[model samples]
Target: MTSQQHQRAAGKRAFITGAAGGLGSATARMLARQGAKVFLTDIDGDAVATVAADINRQAGEKVAWSAPQDVRDEANWERLLAEAALAMGGLSVLVNNAGIGSLGAIGAIELNEWRRVMGVNVESVMLGCKHAMAYLRDAQPASIVNISSLAAFKVDPDYTAYNTSKAAVAALTKSVAVECARQKIDVRCNSIHPAFIRTGIVKPFFDKLGEEEATRKLVRGIPMHRMGDPDDVAYAVLYLASDESRYVTAAELVIDGGARAV
Candidate 1:
C-alpha cells in the first residue's frame, strides 16, 4: 500500500491506561512497534512520561503522546481522549489495563479497599467503554482489550476484591459485545485473564517467597509450573488489537499457561 493508503488504514491510534507500569507498558511498546501511535497515561506523572519517552526514543514518531490519567476518575478519560485526538489523530484501540492488586479475605476485607479495587478495575473499564463507544463505533473495526484475571472465573478467597472486580470486567465484556452487535456498532471487546505474570507489583511478593518456593506456590494449583511474563499477555493483546481477530469478540483470552485449564 502507498503512504496515504497506509495512513488511512492504520487507524492505529491507541490509549493505554496504566501505561507507566507492568503489562500496560509492555503492550504500549508492542503496539507502537506495530505502527500504532500510542497515547499512554498513568496515575504516576513521572512514570507515564518516562515510559512514553522511552517508547519515543526507541520507535521515533510512532510513540505519540503521554500524560497522567487516573482511571478511577471518569473526567480523566474525557481529557485523555481530547488529547489523544490531537496527538494521535483519533482513538481506535483502548487497553483498559489499569487495576490494583490487593489481598483480602471477604470477611476481613475493609470496605474502602474493596470499593477502591472495584472502582479501579471494574468501573474504570466501564467508563472507558462508555466514553469511547461513539468514537470506536464510528472508527469501525475498533478494539477494547480489558485485563481481567484467572481469579475472575476461579475463586480465591484471599483476594476477594481483585477477583470480584475482574469477574465484573468479564461480565461487562460480554454485555458490551452483545450491545455492539445489537446496535451494529462495529466495535469489538474482549477480556484477557492472566495468571501470575512477573510484573513488578508481584515481584516483592515473589521475592519474599524465594524463587523456587514462589514458582511452586504460584503453580501449586495451576497446571503450568511457570509464572507468566508481561510479553506473554502483550502478545495476546496484539492479537485482539489487530484485524487478525476481526470476527472474535466477547471472548476470554486466558494467558495463564494452561493454569486455568486444570
Candidate 2:
C-alpha cells in the first residue's frame, strides 16, 4: 500500500511500568525489537536501568531508556511521564504493567494488605492514564495496555484481593477507553490477562515447592499443562500497543494457556 493509503503510525514511543524484569522487561524488549523506542520504569532503579541498557545494546543503538518510579504516587506519575516524553521526543504508548499477587481469603487478608494491592495494581493504572493522557492525545491514535490477569475473571477464593484488584483494572481500562472515544481523543485503552506466567513474582512458589513440584502444581489448573513464558504476554502487549490493533480498545486480551477455558 502507498503511504497515503497506509494505516496511521503505531505511535511507537512507549513508556512501560514495572519494567525491571519479567513481563515488563520482555514487553519492553519486544517493542524495541519491533522498532518502538521504549522508556522502562520500575520501583527497582538499578534493575530497570540494566534492562534498558541491555535493550539498547541488543538493538545496536539507544532504543530504550529507564527511570525509577513508585506507580502508586500521582506526583511520580506526573514527573515521570514528562521525563519519558521528553526523552523519547514524544510519547504514544503507555503500558501499565506494574501489579502484585496476593494469597489471602476474605477474613484472613489484612485491610492494609488489601489496600496495598489496590494501590499498586488498580490505582496505579488510573494514575497512569490520568497523567499520560495529554501526551497520548498529542500522539494521536495512541494506546494504553494495562497488565491485568486471568484471575480477574477466574477468581480464586484465596486470592481475593489480587482478583479484586485485577477486576478493578479491567473496569478502569474500559472507563478510560470509553471516555476517550466519546470525547474523540483518539487514544485507545485495553487490558491483558495472563495466567501463571513464569515471572519473578512466582519465583517464591517455585523456590518453596521445588521447580519440578511447582511446575506440576501450577500446570494442574492450566489446560496447556505448562506455565507461560514472558514472551507470551509480551507479544500480546506489543499487539495492543501497535497499529495492528488500531480498531481494538477497552478489550481484555487473555494470554493464558487456555486455563480459563477449563
Candidate 3:
C-alpha cells in the first residue's frame, strides 16, 4: 500500500484554475500530497505542465494533471471541466483562483482594462460555479473554493476594479451556496479572502525592488507587519475543500495577516 492509499480526501478530485504558480500551485501540491487527484489549469500551458510534472515526480505517482485554459471562455469551461472530471473520476472540488489586478483608480482606469480585470476576476468564477455545479452535484458533499481578496471589504483607493471584482466573488459564492442548498445538491460553496500574500500578484514587486524593499513596502500597511505565505491560504483552501468543513457554506475565510483588524 502506498501513502496515497491513506486517503484524507476520501476520493476527492479537484479542478483548480490558475494553477501554474503561486496559491493555485501551492494548493494543488498540498491537495495531491493529502491524497487528492488534482487537475490544474492555467493560461500558460508550459508552466502548468511543469507544475503537473513536478507534482507527479515528487509523489511517485500520477496524482496531478494539467491543461491550458482561458477562464473567461464559457465553451472551454464546459469542455475542460468534463475532461477533468473524466480524468480524475469525478470533480468534487473546484477552486476558482484565476484573477488579475487593475492598473489605475476609477478616474484613471481605462474601460478596457476594467473589463479585462472583471472578465478574469469576476466572470470566471461565475462560469466555474455554473459549469461545475452538475459534476459537484453528482459528487455529493462537494466544495467550490473561490479565491477572493481582503480588498473586497478593505477600501483601496487605487484599486477600485480589483476591490469590486473580489466583492462580486464573495457575493457570488453566497448565491451559489444558497442555490445548491435549496436544490438539495449537497455541494458547499465558499470564498477565501487573503491580504498581501507573498505569492499571488505581489511576487512582481519582489522581482522589481528586491525582497527587502518589497517586503517592507507591502507590510507597512498590515498590523502584523508581515505578508502571508502561500501555504497560509493553501491551508485554508484545504480545509474548505474537504469534509472537515461540511457544515460551512457561503463562509468567507480571511487569511489576512491582521490587516483587516487594523
Candidate 4:
C-alpha cells in the first residue's frame, strides 16, 4: 500500500506527555506523519517545543504544538488537558508517557525515593486517565496509552521502586479500561511495556557499567538478542492509538524483544 494509505491516525488529535525525547517524541512524530494533530508536553518546555518544531518541519505542516506540563499534579493535569483540547480542537488520544526510573533494593530504597517513583509512574497515569476522560469520550473511539515497563513483570533486585510503580500502572490501565467499557465511554486504555530500549532512561546503566559491557549484558537477556529502538515502542503506540485497535482495550503491548517470553 502507498504511504498515505497507511496513515492510520489521520484526522485524530493526540496529546502526549514526556514528548521531549525518547519514546514520547518518536510517537509524536509518527502520529504527525500519519496525519494526526498532536500536542506534545513535557516538564522541559524548551525541549518539547524543539521536538514540536522538528515534527512540524519534517511533516511540512502545522501538525504539532508543545506545552510545559507537570503530570504528577492533578490540577496541572486538568488544566493541561483543557488547553490541549483547545489547541487540537479536541482530543482522541492520550499518551501518559512521562515517568522516571529508580534503582535501589527494597532495604536501600529511601521512603522519598519510593514515593517519588510512585507519584510519577503510577499517580500520573491515574490523573491523566481521570482528567482526559471527558474529552476522549466526547471525541469517541479514543485511546489512552500508558508507558509502563517490562520491569513490571520481570523484577530486578535493584529496581524495587521502579518495578512496583510500573506494575501499578499496568493494573491501573486494566481498571480504567473495564470502567470505561462498563460506562460505555467509548474510550480505551492500555499500557506499553518496553524492555531495554536505547533511551535516556538506560544511559545511567551504560554510564555505571562500560557501554560495551552494559549493551552486552542487556542484549544477553533478550531472546531476540537485541535492544529495542524508541521507534519499536512507538509503532506499538501507533497501533494502539489508531482506530484499528477499536476492539482492543486493557491490553499490555510488550515491546521487549522476547525478553519476557524467554
Which of the numbered candidates is closest to the native, going by highest TM-score? Answer: 4
> Which 10 consecutive positions of candidate 2 have the poorest summed lDDT?
1-10
What does candidate 3's lDDT look like per residue over 162-221, in tens digits? 999999999999999999999888999999999998775886888999989999998887
RMSD, candidate 3, Å: 1.6
Whole-model lDDT per candidate: 0.85, 0.90, 0.92, 0.92
| The 10-residue segment with the lowest total lDDT in model 3 | 1-10
What tens digits encode model 1's per-residue C-alpha lDDT throughout 1-262?
A: 1253333325577889998979999998888776778888888989989999988888655555889888988888888787887787777888999998889997989999988998999999999999988768766789999999998988889988988899999999999988998887778999999998988877777779987787788777767678888999988888888877889999999888787778
Clashing pairs in 1: none
Clashes of 3: 0
TM-score, model 1 to reference:
0.94
TM-score of 2: 0.95
TM-score of 4: 0.97
Best of the two (3, 4) by TM-score: 4
Estimate, for each residue in 129-220, the C-alpha lDDT of model 2 and write its tens digit. Answer: 99999999999879999999999899889999999999999999999999999998889999999999998988998889999998998889
Runs off by more than 4 Å, candidate 1: 1-10
lDDT of 4 by residue, 36-105 (tens): 9999999999999999999888888788999998888899888888988998899999999999989899
